[model samples]
Target: MKKDIHIPVVEDVYIAIVNEYNAIYKTQDWNAYIINNKAVDLELVLIVTSGYSKKKATSVFRKKLDKLPKQSYAKIELMQEELFALNNTFKVTFFEGNQMFDKTYLFRENTINLKALQSIPLMAVKGVLAK
Candidate 1:
């Protein structure tokens, strides 16, 4: 059942395990195929909720669960999507899993670099003419 698998989503982050081997390992299975990354017939099936930018999602293991409304689910339709949502989602897992589950490491200062999406104006200026 889909509900058996817990997918965590925050804001615009969306992630999923695509490579069959990684997916198996992620779901807590220790199969040989996953142990050695030996799956040669698998394709990446990353699904995400809308609002995720293409550049921010890029990772093989981490994924974002797309923002689902209260008591609801998300709908994914794009076929050739990018990986930004996945990367952002993975970053969260990386931080959370380290802080809560792994008790081997100590706390340290974490710094983040914020990046803003850029856009160019396409329409002609009203007062200035191109020379």
Candidate 2:
């Protein structure tokens, strides 16, 4: 008789937050905040995608975090134009212990709070602006 091997899946170890940052100069930017809620460190890769056509999707941004400590978070920023053009979706892949995990989040999902983004602090400018 042949036996089947099974692996357990972990749930809710990481959380993602999407928000908008209004710059001091009247410009706006979008940000994705990845928070690790697990007790151990993690290695993560973040990919942003958007619908390119009726049947196809395209990647707009890619970032990798070699190590995200437990209970820590990382912020990834995007320009307003890019966020609007890309339609704002995220695919996050991470490694915890010996297992790998992956999940996708859409902009319209309830997990992402767009209204809270407005309360985020604005980006500060350190240099003078040119006319």
Candidate 3:
């Protein structure tokens, strides 16, 4: 029976952490964003995020979006520099037409630093894309 079910593979959707300048604070900050590179619109987008380590953990955060247009992006949260020492996870789920898709993106410990940034799609700045 399990073999009869089909699970679609997720594509073109990514979670990225970008280092941006905060004009108000006059400092750079790390921020998380969800990028939708799919050709179709995403509906009822939901995301659950958290950070953890061997002896420490951060509170979980939930975010929702009514719709994410094709080739667009949305900011998820501001990530503190201290959190970079721990493993951060982002669980994203959304609907494309009548089908549902979900993906879990992880940024391993000490992996979200400026030295690892690259050109991210749908954004002007460079960032680290979660794996």
Candidate 4:
């Protein structure tokens, strides 16, 4: 990974969004997952911990920002480091509301699904969770 890629360890991430999340990352966190956004096709992915639902995560982040962002926000990106690493491969759901129009995708080793990604508008990727 490149030094300026923004993939800081979880602790460094805490320092950035702590006050807003009661020091919890799941509520608000993220950094570039690849050495360069282009490395992952400029896709800013986050590895996240399980247990919390997307709705809960979105609500907390909105409350912290003091306003709701119309488009999805890349909140709570999972940490990738010795102390806090997430799954190397995972899936994300894309949609325009009541409909889950497409199938899930699998991502691994900094590689993502271009086909599935193309289906999602960049603005709608926020609050997405990978499992």
Candidate with best TM-score: 3
TM-score, cand. 1 vs. native:
0.15
Candidate 3 per-residue C-alpha lDDT over 1-131 given as tens digits, one digit per residue, 9 for 90 to 100: 99999888999999999999999999999999999999999999999999999999999999999999999999999999999999999999999999999989999999999899999999989999999
The digit string of per-residue lDDT tens for model 4 on 1-131 reads 58665432211111111112226535633332211111112122323222223232221111122222232333334432221222232222222233322222222222222222321223323222232
Model 2 Cα shift for residue 72 (angstroms): 0.7
Better of 3 and 4 by lDDT: 3
lDDT-best of 1 and 4: 4
Q: What is the TM-score of each candidate against the true structure?
A: 0.15, 0.57, 0.98, 0.24
lDDT of 1 by residue, 1-131 (tens): 99796554323222222211235335421110010011121122232222234444322332333222322222222222232233122122212322211111111111111121122122111111100
lDDT per residue for candidate 2 within 36-125, as digits (tens), equals 666788875555545343444555677788888876667755434333433356667778887787776555423233333332222221
Quote the lDDT for 43 in model 4: 21
Q: Count the backbone clashes (under 3 Å) in each candidate.
A: 11, 0, 0, 4
lDDT (CA) for every model shown?
0.22, 0.51, 0.96, 0.25
lDDT, model 1, position 108: 15
Colliding pairs, model 2: none
Models ranked on lDDT:
3, 2, 4, 1
Better of 1 and 2 by TM-score: 2
Candidate rank order under TM-score:
3, 2, 4, 1
